[model samples]
Target: MTQESATVDPPGDELFARVPTEVSVYEVSPRDGLQNESTLISLEGKRRLINALVAAGLRRIEVTSFVSPKWVPQLADAEELARVLRAPEGITFSALCPNARGLERALSAGLSEIAVFLSASEAHNKANINKTIADTLAVFSEIVPPAREAGLLVRAYVSTVWGCPYEGAVDPARVVKIAEKLLDLGCYQISLGDTIGVGNPRQTREIVRRFLDVMPPERFALHMHDTRGTALANVLTALEMGVRDFDASVGGVGGCPYAPGAAGNLATEDLVFMLQSMGISTGIDLDKLIEAGNVAEQVIGRALPGKVHKAGPFRLRRSPTRAS
Candidate 1:
């Protein structure tokens, strides 16, 4: 895709004037993508997926999670993935750590970055992590400080910000408060998750507006699932609102194992195709990203939901248009 493929004239161009020149993409395929997979990807296959993502020029990657294997059996090999995956110097590898034990495991595995998460809806929080929103915050008090003191990069996740499967509409004010608490506890960034993919662009923009009132846009990242097929539209709204950080999974492999009826995440190749076509640099090699998506398909033993990977990155080579 190229700028010449699409054009906007005069007043039309004003609508997109706020779009950023470049955005940092936080790759979450290894952790979020694989955790929802029922097939147990071999240790070697996990290594291949991580290497493939790095090969596609992804700088920040979530390698694995330290949650109990009983809950997410697919990621039981978190320690092994951390130990064996030797990413390049500039690459940032992170993992999801649910509690003190998870953090300790990440520390022992020599991971330099880790993430903590809790839901915005009270019911969903209990279902996902077996804790109330208040209890989860208490646990974060225990997790974030020591991790920060040890010089580790800490990120936080606020799930179900847009809508919850159990409780439907969640209060945006509560979401903002959770983000504030995470920031006070030393989290460098917070990824806001639409865990069940029920968000629309209008709601997304309004929710983001409320968040930007109290926090810097750069401190937030959008993690959208495509269950309702509106993830891209919501992401566009976020971009227009001055957000530059995004979370994506290659081949669209993801779902909250706890959130019934949840779908995969926004596809990495699809996202890159949109961003790069708009002349917003993501610093990713799109062709290699498609190949990485293929690696994911192979690891999962089936086709995934990402479109660009299957369709290839090229648009139809149309002949020059003729005016009748």
Candidate 2:
């Protein structure tokens, strides 16, 4: 055998541990990240970005939200975007559906996966969707069955799972209850979102521990914002607890329009870097992910919050030739 063939790859072994070091990264830049931006990306631009992401090996992508154009003008082309989305085989393209109307639109647009959002805190749900938590639950009951009937995979977004900007600290029990309801309503996975980025490792572990009591860790996903710079720390806590699915935006390009003072979701580039450093296998090409972030910045006409986008990945230089 050649010398190179004799050397075993240690990094592959590290990724094989029972605990998943590399979690699935859901790129939401096209949908959630762009929804709140002031600049409008054209239908063609959205398609170009999505195609690029798929080409870069992103299998799960949030393409758009099926909501009122009057409310979110950025995603006004949701139908067209979803219809023309040319994703690779086995690649899942999902959209955020607010209600039955939105679900109908998503079905018409040919999406097989749809995500529904509800807030744990009353004030947040009210501000975000103009409905109380109780009212939102009533809507979910109607929304879920029809979606399942249409042969779509339903994922739920439980927002403000940690601290809410308006309500301060949220009760873990409330988040758990909402998650159970969404799951009972036929959502295969519940994405717990720290809408305002106020959660730290301690709070994240506590909440995740509680959720583990009711649901398997694999059935849950974490969505964090870096408004307070604690998103990666919270992600580490979740990873240590055996949670493996995460939601992130390229270039950290999202914030809550309803939750004032909230920053963007944890950047995909930052998350991938942390996971890969620990010898995890996310199946994502880091360099391509960073390139996607650059495209996002250009589309939004502003700098993204992701540090990696600002600084290139760490590399060591070779020794320079000296005068012999």
The TM-score of predicted model 2 comes to 0.92
Question: Model 1: clashing residue pairs?
Answer: none
- Please name the candidate that would achieve the greatest lDDT relative to the true structure: 1
177-232: candidate 2 lDDT, tens digit per residue: 88898889999999999998889899998998998888888789999999989999
Native-referenced Cα lDDT, model 1 = 0.91
Error of 1 at 260 (Å): 2.9
Clashes of each: 0, 1
**Which candidate ranks first by TM-score, i.e. highest?**
1
lDDT of 1 by residue, 1-324 (tens): 777776755475666777888999999988889887777899999999999999999999999999999988999999988999786899999999999999999999998999999999999899888889899999999989999998899999999998888888998988988899999999999999999999999999888998899988888999999988998999899888878999999999987887888877999998999999889999999999999999999988998999888888777786798678
**TM-scores, one per candidate:** 0.93, 0.92
For model 1, the run of ten residues with the poorest summed lDDT = 6-15
